[model samples]
Structures are given as C-alpha cells and as structure tokens.
Target chain A: EADIYQTPRYLVIGTGKKITLECSQTMGHDKMYWYQQDPGMELHLIHYSYGVNSTEKGDLSSESTVSRIRTEHFPLTLESARPSHTSQYLCASSGTYNEQFFGPGTRLTVL
Target chain B: GESVGLHLPTLSVQEGDNSIINCAYSNSASDYFIWYKQESGKGPQFIIDIRSNMDKRQGQRVTVLLNKTVKHLSLQIAATQPGDSAVYFCAESRGFQKLVFGTGTRLLVSP
Candidate 1:
C-alpha cells in the first residue's frame, strides 16, 4: 500500500472560511502533486512541487496555494473557501518513473 | 493545448470476463502513460503504466497497451471481478513532467 495520507477525509465549512488540507507521504518522493476532482469527473491538476521550496501551478486554475517546506509534506490552503471550491482534493507522490501514488482524498463542501 | 480523453464514459462488464478501457491523447510528445483506478469515496490508485518505448506491459491480471502511432492507450483487466468496479483513468506525461489526466471511464462489473 502507498504511504501517502490526507487528513479530514471530509470537510464542510461556510463560505469565506480559510481551510488547509493536509497531505503527507513517507515514501521520500521528490514530486508531490495536488489535484481537484468532481464527483465522477476527470481530475485536474492544481498545484505541484518538485522538491522542497519548489512549487509550480498546474494546468487548471485554482485559488488554493501550496507550500513544500519539507519533502514529506505538501499542504494546500484556500484563503477564502467558496462554494465553487468545493470538490475532492487529492494528494499524490511520485518517483522517477512518474507512477503517482495517491492518498485517500479529502472531500470538501462549502456551504 | 494538449488533453487526454476517453472514448467511453462508462463501460459495463460481467464477472469473469475480460474488460478493456480506452483513452486517446492529443499530445504525441507524451512519453509515459499510466492507468489509475479510483473507487467511490477514495483516492485514485496506481494500476499500471507503460513507457513510449514499449508497446505493452503487464501486471498481475492487468495489462497496459500503448499505440504511439495513434496516440492511444488501453487498459485490460482479466477475469473482471466485483472488486474491479470503479472509475478507470489514463494519464500521459512528457519527459517525466506533470501528467495530463483523461476523463475517467466508470467500470461496472456485474455478477
């Protein structure tokens, strides 16, 4: 099984609340990624980090920001969560071959 | 812009039969391809992968076929079981960079 983990498998909050979704991996992978997926829809990459202090935006535009201060941790934060930001946030880690191991996603609901 | 997509949004198969899910990518430059399985209320799990250099790769009861000529990729599952019912996604990446995930195909396996 993959060593990746995500906290608060489900979250519900009001609009304008600041929320942080936690992601961590024990695999010592240099590549970490965050993807947003709707129910039964395709996943869209929102943010990624090559290594510590290296972060980049992904194909989809997202209001969330990510920080990679440590190799094992890559957390995504939404400054002001809105209803549109409500979706499943998935965290993944990958090695050289690029086969990503994903964590059990965090499903967010902004009421 | 490059994108990956699936031909069928949903596939229905019977238990103990073979199942095939197809995907097409617009970017010919993508060198690595991977298949992922996502169950309801869970993150996507890595299933199998294939590099552009090879045409086929196999895992336990699962096979990945790549046809670079048509920029097509496929996942084959042998003796489909109830446990195999989930959403299957194909992702492509170029030079080990970020991946472009295709719209998933839901696999419904019935007894």
Candidate 2:
C-alpha cells in the first residue's frame, strides 16, 4: 500500500468556513502535488511543490493555498470556503520520473 | 491549459477477458506517459508507465502502449477480474516535470 495519507475523507461545511485538508507521505518523495476533481470529470492540478519552502500554482485557478514546510507534509487550506470549492482533493508524490503514488483523497462538500 | 479528457468513457468486460482503454493526447513534447487506476472515492494510483522512446511496456498482467506518432496511448489488462473494476487515467509529462492527465475511462469487469 502507498504511504500517502489524506485527512477528513469526507467533509461537509457551511459557506464561508475555513478548512484545511492534510496530506502526508512517509516515502520521502521530493515532488508533491494537489489536484481537484469532480465525479466523472478530468482532474485539475491546483498546487504542487518541489521541496520544502517551494510551492507553485498549477494550470488551474484555485482559491486554496498550500504549504510545504516539511518534505513529508503538504497541506492545503481555504481561508473562506465556498460551494464552488466542493470536490475531491487528491494528493500525490513521486520520485524522479517514477510513477506517482496517490492518497485516499479528501471529499469536500460546501453548503 | 491543456485539455484532458472531459467525459469518462466506460468499458464493460467479462471476467477472464482482456480489456483495452485508449487515450489521445495533444501535447507533442510529452516524453513520458503513465496509467493510473482509481477506485470509487479514492485517489488515482499508478498502474504503469512508458517513456516516449519505448512503444510498449508490461507490468504483471497490465500492459501500456504508447504511440507517439499518433499521440495516442493505450492500456491493456489481461485476464480481467472483478477486482480490476475502477477508473483508469492516462497522464503525459514533458521533460519529466508537470503532468497532464486525461479525463479517464471507467472499467467494469463482470463475474
């Protein structure tokens, strides 16, 4: 099994609430990424990090922000969540050009 | 932004049969391609990958075929089983960096 993990597998919160989704991996991978996806839709990369203190936005526009202070931890936070942000968030990690290992994912629902 | 598959195409196959799922990508600079499998309410897990220099690679009962000439990729699963039911995705990478993922195909293996 993959070592990657995501917290709050399912979440339902009211509008304008603050939320943080946690992602961590014990594989010691340098590349970490966060993607947002809806049911039966294409995944959109939202954020990625090369290493600690390095984070970049992906091709898609996102309201969530991420921090990579530790190699094993990359967390995403939405200061003010909205209904538009409802989707499944996936965390992935990779080494070199090897395949990416994904977490179980966090399903977020905004009301 | 590059376009991944928008709709999730589905394939139903009988147990013990072989299944093939195809994907077409637009990026010509993509040098690496990978296949991922995702179960319901979970993140995508890597299945196999092939570099642009190679046309095919095998992993256990799974095979990945990359056709750079047509910018198309395909995945074949031999001896399909009910446990193989899940969504499969194709991802392309340029220069071994950022990845562009296809919308994905759902496979259902009947017993």
The most accurate candidate by lDDT is: 1
For every candidate, what is the interface RMSD in angstroms? 6.1, 4.9
Candidate 1, B31: how far from true, in Å?
1.9
Task: Give one digit per residue, the lDDT tens place, for model 1 in B45-102.
Answer: 8899888999999999999999999999999999999999999989999997878888
Model 1 residue pairs with clashes: none
Q: Candidate 2 on A61-87: residue-level lDDT in tens?
A: 998999999999999999999888888
Report, for all candidates in order, the number of backbone clashes.
Answer: 0, 1
| Pairs with backbone N, CA or C atoms under 3 Å apart (clashes), candidate 2 | B5-B103
Global lDDT scores for all candidate models: 0.91, 0.90
The superposed Cα distance between candidate 1 and the true structure at residue B89, in angstroms, equals 0.7
Model 1 in CAPRI terms: which quality?
acceptable
Q: For residues B1-111, could you state the per-residue lDDT of candidate 2 as single tens digits?
A: 123337688999999999999999989989899999998887888888899999999999999998888999999999999999999989988886778888799999999
TM-score (all chains, Cα) for each model: 0.93, 0.92
